[model samples]
Target: MTTPSQDRPTPQDRPTPQDRLTPDELRTLFLFEALSPEQLDWLAERGRVERREAGEVVYREGEPATCFFILLSGALSLNRVLHGDDVEVTRTDQRGVYSGATRAYLGDRVEQLYPHTLRAVSDAEFFVLPADEFAYAVRTWFPMALHLLEGLFFGTRAANAIVNERERLLALASLSAGLTHELNNPAAAALRATAGLRGRVTGMRHKLAMIADGRLDGAGLHRLVALQDDAVQRAATGVSMTAMETADAEDTVSDWLDERGLAGAWDLAPSLVAAGIGVSWLADAARTVGAEHFEAAVRWITYTIDTELMMGEIDDSVERISELVGAARQYSQLDRTPLQIVDVHDLLDATLTMLQARIPDGVRVVREYDRDLPSIPAYGAELNQVWTNLIVNALDAMPDGGTLTLRTWREDDRLMVEIADTGVGIAKDVRPRIFEPFFTTKQVGEGTGLGLDISYRIVVNKHHGDLRVTSRPGDTRFQVCLPIEQTAEATETAESGETTEAGGAAEASEDG
Candidate 1:
């Protein structure tokens, strides 16, 4: 735990603040060397020299950034708070290096909090200017330069947001098309089955009328209705049969029907056999209804069984459609809180569902999720985009079909998700540039080259996490590490940035 500020020594605990630099003394630093004599004088009057002991924080992140500090002597490091732990991002001993309220000139348009913590690695000296004064001097000294800088900063951000949106829409369109294809299969099956079911129901009603036309008494008709119920039950729990076994069963039923002089025996035999009805069941039917009523009773029962079987198919197909629709909603995170504690496995499963049509029959997906891993606070829809990009890249990697594996586990205070592909791996020369913006290996018109770059920003910049890759022929993996707990930096990034959806490159090892 950090000691409260009051418990730490103040400047009074050490030597007094050093005298301000003279104009010539300020010009000795590289940063001020380009300044005019008048500009140097202006800085010398405003900037003060401050000393710090090693291991002391100059300013904590998320504090109201109040000053700008330029190195004079000694070494220092920059650290970002991640999951309550200070993780060092950089260290420098170069004179004139600066830190602190670097973006103060942006004014109230953006929050003025320090983006990272600054710490002295050794007893250090820095020239400090109050943040407001620094902002005034920078704007006054170079108004045009400041305007250009502002344009560049905000322009890049705006461009990224626009492109990120385009990327997301493209992905959504592709997935929606795939979903349409997947939904069509079951929907078509249900449509055809419904029509067939209506016909079977009508045929059963006509057959029933024939059986009860006084040729069979109420008691016999009641017996036939009981037989119909049994047939329907059998159809529900139909037996699985091999080709030869099915052929033999159908032949036996057909022979029995033919021997009784029933027409369409061959056609009727298959449906009866499919419902596990055989010669023994036929004997019982004949005994209950007698010779004259046996044929009509058998036809009605067959139609009843067939109709029940068709309804089962329709039920299964409709249920499948419902499941697909549910998975689509889950994948899109529609109706979900943008930021919430979420199960990683659910996100993975939903991505897989959305990509089901795009995944080739030859490419198999294997999930290796550690269910015990704690849920994490995250932007659900954004993470789904990360999954989509990674999985799509994996599919592209294995054009001829291979295993695509998704694995998740807990590593320290972070959760790690790995997407692996068994395909021609990423080239060694290209690996370093994989996450650079607009760096793609795909041919023109095929990729945007921002998939991994956006993924890196979301995972690293936004989540205060890490993304890493390792590759070899037939074995390539991209691992995304996310903090399981919300850190101060995560909160700051959330407050500062727009949440954007991610997309994948069409080529393997994403160039888009």
Candidate 2:
């Protein structure tokens, strides 16, 4: 084989003009196909073929919609740069053409001005048609003009659809962020309580073992029982008390009880009583068991109560977790089809649960639900997404943590759900675009600015409902209004247990 350098074509070795484009070759381009041979030749003389390397910048947006281009080879990526970042707008392959000539020919106001830039991804070739010639061709050829116009319209629509999708993705990102934050709290609390309960239960088992072993007399047993009682009480107090205070009180009682061996004594109570030690004998034994034993008894009681309280806490935590999971399932409507009859409360509750992970530690969530609310036909998952976005956004505004109040009430024929947050209020200027896609006050990468936009679509476009927001410093509320009835099919499905809508479910509330 010849060496690569020797095999490469020299400048003189390249094809001449006659070889590159024959007279017939000029007529083959789709847009120019209708031109007469003489006209095609005239056009070809003015046309310029340009080559761009990979990663080359071809054009900028808002640069006059001048000469149109037909890509003869390679790929082109299109993007809009906003706020110092490149947001990809679209991408086209080799068969694509970048022509805004229809707008120029029609004399319509250009919707997008450009210094918008285009870059080539690989070595590429394009045919640039002069503005005047292209305009003349478009106006003179009805089919060509119509084709160009249709292409332009389709391109515009595609661009719009891409933009809408981006906005939606951004909103989803924000909602997910908020949801992650919401999940952490109850999860952490439950873990801590579970750990505490394990320790308490261990200690309780040891004390019961000692009592079963007959290691203590009736008096010691009585003192130990009393200590167990006191421990339970103290544990209850711990629930309402500061952690440090609770720990200190617990430690003191535990130490005093240990000194008297009251742990062992209380552990022996049942055996002592079984061995014929009476209550009177045990009371007398308490006097002999000493102040240390009494202290130990008190401590043990406190701890027992603490254990119980912790158990209750764990139970409550589990319930909350269940509620959250249920809410999520309902909100996402994962088990159901895309469109279903949904209970508004289920959607709201799921949204709250999802955002539960995000609410600040100091913030409290309150709910006032309307008992008379009814189910509506909707896309449950999408509607849940709407609620999740709004409520989570509200939680984010309150950095120091305030109250998030949710209310549902019936107005006229509509059912309304309102979510209000006590956070730094929305500014007037930004409020206008809050529901616009990809608009955000959050730091870059921290938010996508799509939450409210998607919410608006879900409520207004999909559900045929109303979504409105009212905000002030320390108070921001979002109101969602939806119809109360579903179509006959929805009702029939619901009756058959094939579908479960969230409407008519009891209003539920959560506090953080």
Index of the highest-TM-score prediction? 1
- Please, what's the RMSD in Å of model 1? 7.6
Per-residue alpha-carbon lDDT of model 1 for 228-336, expressed as tens digits?
8899889988999999999999999999899999999998998899899999999988998898888888888889888888899899999999999988988888888
Total clashes for model 1:
5
- After superposing candidate 1 on the true structure, give the runs of residues whose Cα lies further than 4 Å from its correct spot: 1-30, 373-377, 456-468, 482-512
List candidate 2 stretches off by more than 4 Å.
Answer: 1-310, 361-366, 392-405, 420-449, 469-477, 486-512
- Scanning candidate 2 in windows of ten residues, the lowest lDDT window is 503-512
Evaluate residue 202 in candidate 1 and report its C-alpha lDDT on the 0 to 100 scale.
Answer: 89
| Overall local distance difference test of candidate 1 | 0.82
Global lDDT of each candidate: 0.82, 0.61
lDDT of 2 by residue, 144-259 (tens): 64576656655645664676567557655655675555556678888999998888677767666555777567867876665455444544443344657545544544444455
How many pairs of residues collide in each model? 5, 40
RMSD of each: 7.6, 18.4
* Number of the top-ranking candidate, with lDDT as the measure: 1
